[model samples]
Target: MGVYSEGFLEAVDAALADFEVEIRQLGAAASDAQILAAIERVVLALNSVSQGVAGGVIDTDEREQLCLFIDEVMTENGIEVGELAARHGVSRYAITDRWRRW
Candidate 1:
């Protein structure tokens, strides 16, 4: 049984795709403040996804994919998984377990 429908995952993917484009556009020419703002957006997005998973709005497979996405985003932004886990009130082990599967 799945907690999230296929339509939900597709919507998430579409939103992520838009985010990626926005990040790219905030490239070298973007100011330090702009970069920080962009990072904040990513953080908010990850937090939203984490909250959804924690609240049982996302299924196991969706959680796995979201975790992978979170890992990638953290790596790219030089953020620590432990830091994110702490912020989200989730166990680092849980995050890492899904991240490893990615």
Candidate 2:
């Protein structure tokens, strides 16, 4: 009954975990640029984690998952959006703007 296979979901989860690890390693003093770059990498990885997932097919649930993942990462890493934007001129909400396919 799932839109995606369990294996594909697991891979996506792993990709998120990898991004979380990167954020944890970056710690409290990480520059916005650094965090944004990591976000870009994970967005790309998520966009490509499974075949037949491209061409503007990001479903509602998938989008929610992505947003939650990104927000949770920022929260867990103590990333303040206004501060990060001031630091690097990049909005935290815009992390997927430059990298996500859908």
Candidate 3:
């Protein structure tokens, strides 16, 4: 089994739920394998969204909301500030500064 936390799993589930309708629509015409592949892509895209937010690739009004979601998930999972900073190639202070404003 994977070592994902409850918070992380919940986040993934929520993200997937957002696409449930579309996925079901595709399932109507697609083969089972194709449907599965589409679901996998959705998961991958959701994962990329988080990475993009962390690496500062996203630049829109929604960025702050996405950042806050990421922060909440990380906090719930007990991820250290320094670890998140290192993952994003940023400083620990930068992470704390953003959190402080939230």
Candidate 4:
């Protein structure tokens, strides 16, 4: 089982929301798949946001990679993950269970 701290999850959620808003602004329709895809893209974009936080223009690819990396880090940190997973409309167990497939 992987873990994720509350703070980290909050940051990720905030970042994901930002990413979703941007995608919608780009003219993507409001569908289940589109929403999900937009979220994934935004998570990927988290790397860029992290970089930009340190003074950069936000490389989109970097953001994606950073998010993936963060999840691993969260697991290593031993923070109880899955609580925030429910926000995505899935069970906390499912979110933390083999979540990489998402």
Candidate 5:
């Protein structure tokens, strides 16, 4: 068992799936604009999930999994997280920190 419920995990998976779709929809020549938009949406979705789960409060374990999830999704879509963070002047682990209220 994990720190999150099955429903919570499902929501996270759906968010990631939608993110992949959004990126692929822009085709192989995905604009940086497209990438950034999709990133924002997914991060928002994760934030919503957290809110729905427990008043937007993410525990330590849930936060770890959520961060890992974003990193993997970005890498899978050929989005270099290092460069993404560099552009925002944040750490790679902080990629999802912008919209992550929890």
Candidate 6:
């Protein structure tokens, strides 16, 4: 089990931005495998950020619910904090700080 925090959304958003850029670069290569690889890379990036955030918090069913909520928010906004942070070249702590404001 794992908990999701606002930080999670931030992390995903940051990763998404990077992923989009990566997809574009791969798109220029014009290969299906390259595009798929780029997508997988984005997923891995997001997974890495989520693992980091989850590791910092408690591990339990309650935490999983929280993470679900975070995913919902990210979906609505079509962005993620981690991805945004990466786009801006900032630290996760900085992304967490932004969440603290909320």
Tens digit per residue, CA lDDT, model 6, 1-102: 434567776776686677556654544434444543544455566556646665333334533444454434333444444554466566423433233212
lDDT of 2 by residue, 37-90 (tens): 888888888778744443334565777678677877778778775576556665
> How high is the lDDT of residue 84 in model 2?
69
> Model 3: which ten-residue window has the lowest total lDDT?
93-102
Worst 10 residues of 2 by lDDT: 50-59
lDDT of 3 by residue, 30-101 (tens): 453443354345446555654533332333444455445544444443445456467657664454333222
Overlapping backbone residue pairs in candidate 5 total 0
**Clashing residue pairs, backbone N/CA/C < 3 A, model 3:** none
What TM-score does prediction 2 earn? 0.77
Off by over 4 Å in 6: 1-4, 55-102
- lDDT, candidate 5, 1-102, per-residue tens: 246677787887898788877766754467666666777898898888878864235667777877787677667767777886788788899876777776
Q: What is the lDDT of residue 5 in candidate 3?
A: 49
Model 4 per-residue lDDT tens digits across residues 1-102: 234455555555686567545544634234445444544565455544443343333234544454554444333434333534555667533432232322
Query: In lDDT terms, how accurate is model 4?
Result: 0.46
lDDT of each: 0.53, 0.73, 0.47, 0.46, 0.74, 0.49
Model 1, 40-81: lDDT tens digits are 565455445545543235446765665566456544654465
Candidate 3 lDDT (Cα, whole model)? 0.47
Model 1: colliding residue pairs: none
Per-candidate TM-scores read: 0.42, 0.77, 0.32, 0.31, 0.74, 0.42
Off by over 4 Å in 1: 1-8, 53-102
- Listed per candidate, the RMSD to the true structure in angstroms reads 7.9, 3.2, 15.6, 12.5, 2.8, 13.6
For every model shown, the clashing-pair count is: 0, 0, 0, 8, 0, 20
Candidate 2's C-alpha runs over 4 A off are 50-57, 86-91
